[model samples]
Target: MSLKKLISIFFLISNFIFALEIQPTMFEQRIDGSGGYREFIVSNNTNSTLRYKLTIFPGSKKDRDMSKWTEVSPKILTIKPGRNGIFKIFVQTPKEISDGEYDYTLSLKTMDLPKLPGETDKIASAAKLNFDFRLNFIGYAGDLNPDIDFINPVVSTNANGKTVISGTIVNKTPKRGIYCAVNVISGENSLNYSEIRVPVNGEKQFSVTLEPNVKKSDITGITIRNLENSDIILKKPI
Candidate 1:
């Protein structure tokens, strides 16, 4: 579906909440190297107990219309005032998922709440909603799934007797990616570094050299920075 159309649906869905918020406690799907179980965490951010329907976009716009997201639990749950609870949703990847990145969305929607004795309107105004959220899954074909791997401690060498540093970067997303810059810091010594880009399922190499006469022990560590996030200590040797 077109990006504009997809966002419109999210707009409508989020507008219905009343006096409550719904969102993933943690929006990212974290896959360990263990068996193929994918997990998601959802949270309620308000004082009153909340009810929600968890849905997964099976694939394509068609799957969304089919109502394929299986609910993680049936009985309604309660969280004490000023506290939060956890609900786990476990999904098993099919043995034969096509050999590439797959895209999907996990959504938390608030089921309608019963109205007060005299209340006629059912929809809650946006201001009253505590939380609204969406999670996107981008699966990649590499060992670590390009979706989450960010390599730091780029390669470096001596340049004209100066310190130079740089290294390759890969975008682990299943979809196309844009160029991102790395953030670096040097100790009292001058350390030079540059940024590089990698495509989806792709990798690039870069280098930065240290100042002339700079010794290894004088260096502490390198920090890698991206616009959306920051990663550091790519390499540290005493």
Candidate 2:
């Protein structure tokens, strides 16, 4: 198979593993409104009951100063060989955090456990759960209207009577997006459909063709939107 196919398969399996189980089964929250707070969870999937420490930190440079902001919560959980445990944390989310999306990583590790016979010192099996925490203060708010401008929004026909349309995307938002679907709507009905993705701050080209003898006049523009909810349309008559 092609390298592209291999990469796709790799990402698919990675995502599946991520959703299979929660490493830390429990969490405790302490906060003043939306200010800073501590969060913790413990997972015990090993033979012996292990002592652990959990830390949640900012996932960006602006949050790097968080070294001093760290909070050491009380020892929280006792994970049996088969079950996980929970821990409480202290955190603060200031009122100014209600603008866009924020990302964070919750790091969990075995506390300074004494070295065991023939055991490695590495405490964490994997990095803490990394995820983008989006705080949309605007609420469900109305969906923003999207404006799409294709890089090469033109269709070319060949002697064999095949029509191919190609184009690119220019996202004008601070947020990244992934294109989910493409629809070729003609008048009241859609003539052709496809699923495609356009990475954030990037462009992609797709070719859609009609059967031999199908005139271009029957085709309308194509609409492209992201899985994260952004839309762009390519007009044909233009």
Which candidate wins on TM-score?
1
Candidate 1: deviation at residue 187, Å?
9.1
Worst 10 residues of 1 by lDDT: 26-35
* Cand. 2 Cα-lDDT: 0.45
Q: Against the true structure, what is every candidate's RMSD?
A: 11.0, 11.9
lDDT of 1: 0.43
Query: Across residues 1-238, which tens digit of lDDT does each residue of candidate 2 receive?
Result: 9999778656644642343234222222212244334333444554434554455555453532232333546533345444666555444544333332233444544343444455433322221222222211101101222344556666678777776665665554333334445766667666666665443355667667866655667566766654333344444432
Query: Please, what is the TM-score per model?
Result: 0.43, 0.37
After superposing candidate 1, which stretches have Cα over 4 Å from the reference? Answer: 1-35, 59-80, 114-133, 140-169, 172-219, 223-233, 236-238
Question: What 10-residue stretch in candidate 2 is worst by lDDT?
Answer: 134-143
Candidate achieving the largest lDDT: 2
